[model samples]
Target: MSTTLSPLIDLQLKGFKVYEKNLTLQEAERPLLAAQIFSRRDYYKVLLLESKCVLHYAHQRLELDGGQYLFFTNPHIPYSLELRTDRLHAYACLFTEEFVAAARSESLHQSPLFRIGSTPLFKLPASQADYVRGIFHKMLAEQQGDYPFKGDLIRTYVQLLIHEALHLQPADPVVQPNNAATRLTSLFLELLERLFPIELPTQQLTLKTPQDFADRLAVHVNHLNKAVKQVTGKPTSAHIAGRILDEAKALLQHTDWSVASIATCLGFEYPTYFNNFFKKHTGVTPLSLRRKD
Candidate 1:
């Protein structure tokens, strides 16, 4: 079943928050940890968990039992957690890509923990678990403190957690059926959705074709086409065109960017190409769409 896990918003800052699993719940309230089935969120997450549970992450599954586990998830991938027993204890840190951009680390999305197709779960040794727990404790304290530089301190802790996970070997996922098509389709969609909202005029879409996505996902174009068609009932090119069309309409209606700027941002070599594509898909020019709004 599909579910949406809402973020615990931080009023002081829009993008980052930390949670102690038990403290957030009332005496009569149960944790909603299991409500994350196949859900995607618009932030990055690092979780330190002490529970017996099953994690359905993208196309992979991991069964964790009474061990200290560290999990990393990004906005693009979909994941879920199923508790095997009710005794749950965990600490989670959630932040957006913008929140940690100020850190002196490499791009968080390119990190092994958050990269697509990389393993996200790790089983930590008892001693390492204690060290990881200490970082989370510091994050919790800094999040509530009145220090003006607390955001910077929290970002440093987030980097520490990521660096720690980088040194650990990721846990192996449980073996499953040969559902390559489903797995590839899920990954394709995730990659497609990752380049969205077009927050700035200078921001550009990178993977705009089936071959581009295929190369990024490390699959042949034919295989990607077959898999996307088999799973989504549409060709890979159709999906790409559909998403571009949607973004074109949204940009035209919502922003004051010139048609040429929008065209370049969407990866068109020329505004004429964008014009033809938009009219072909929507039967109206980009300017016409804007005028209607």
Candidate 2:
């Protein structure tokens, strides 16, 4: 069975939460734990896992042997965790952007450690892991207290955690070929995935065409198109159209936003253009799809 964890709902209920688990009990005494799949969230997460597990994050998969590792994720990326051993011990802190407002230098989502395509996993040395564990213990203890300024104190702890991870060396870069097609294709995909989950109706997609993406990737349009096609077996325009179509369908089905609003947010200059595009690709109008739903 699979489970979808939504931190947005949790953060709406409580701006912040911290928890820990130690699953070292004997097999007969242990409780069943299912793999957790989480979609994009509007909050940030900091996790320390001391277990053997496979982490599927965005477009990358990481197999972590039994050891302490610090992981950071922001609102844009989705990830899942599958435990490989019964000796799972972990601590996690989840908080909305407002929870750390006082401590942030800029949007946490834009930070290098949490930004898309940047490495967020760091293997911790024993000494650093012990220090990190102590910080989590403090967070847990203070979370139960009645101090009026505890919220401020907790924010400091969260900032400290970010600082600690920033000081540590990140894991070796995932090995990929130096070939231009492979590298360009990987960068193109990451750039494409970054502009997603359009959480607010006021938010608008800035890069809407293959040329737009190619410009941002700093290669000629033809170069990007050729490389993407060579590596992914599809033209760049096809991929862009496919992603936009997926997001359009998702918004039409899951959201109450009007067609005009959806069109504007999706970078369409006019609703008529959006209507034609959607119908041409899906053989149904956006409104029809919503009404059918």
Candidate 3:
């Protein structure tokens, strides 16, 4: 099965949580684990290694030695790690986008770590590794505590890790753009993905149509549609509708929010409207999906 943040967290901790792990795996288990492919998800994952390894990230294959940091992984990329040593000691931090949604709202998508073609693998010197490891250690320790503001503290640590990575020179230089179509399509998709997870009931998705995205990207609707269709092999409207449908299904299946509240969160004026939209795309009502689960 593909690994997502929630299920992976369940293997280690509890709800919407963040924690660090120091792993020592046997060489015999490496091949079995390496064969697994992890698709991207709406979460941020960072790995700091105490031993050597090879990282497979989308089209880039990187060899990272001890005291190295693998840059942040976001939903737009697919990645995995392979250990080279019998006992690999590494610190990995994983947290969902919703966990840091409020704090990083304006800048998460713009981070260099998520920029396509930017190198994400960085080798940290011993001193720098200690500094970064200190933050991870604190997060791991505090996760075991019952402090009232523990979650906020962990968020702060996550921010620190990102900032620390930013302080270093990027591993690879940015690639030149291909064409207007690809650039526009990338911008459009980034804009679309930015307003996601719908963390709060009052937080609604404001961009609900191709025109909304076009205006945000400062392009004419027809131009945006052509660019998106050419790159994604789907109509612009279909992309918007599909993303909305995905978030709707996730909320219905994962949360206890009522159908009406979900509809409002998804920018539908009414619950009935969301019902029809969901039914049109998926063969079942939101209520039924939730119940079936």
Encode model 2's per-residue lDDT on 206-259: one tens digit a residue.
998888998898889999999989987889988777777767876776578999
Ranking by TM-score: 2, 1, 3
Query: What lDDT score belongs to each candidate, Candidate 1 first?
Result: 0.77, 0.78, 0.70
Q: Which stretches of candidate 3 lie over 4 Å from their true place?
A: 1-16, 22-40, 105-107, 170-293
Give candidate 3's TM-score.
Answer: 0.51
Best by TM-score: 2
Q: Per lDDT, what order, best first?
A: 2, 1, 3
Error of 1 at 179 (Å): 17
In angstroms, how far off is 175's CA in candidate 3?
5.0
Residue 119's C-alpha lDDT in candidate 2? 69
Q: What would the TM-scores of all predictions be?
A: 0.55, 0.60, 0.51
For 74-149, candidate 3 gives per-residue lDDT tens digits of 6555455677876666666666666777568655556677665456677777788889889878887777765556
Candidate 2 vs candidate 3, lDDT winner? 2
Q: Is candidate 1 or candidate 2 better by lDDT?
A: 2
Error of 2 at 177 (Å): 13
C-alpha lDDT (0 to 100) for residue 148 of candidate 1: 57
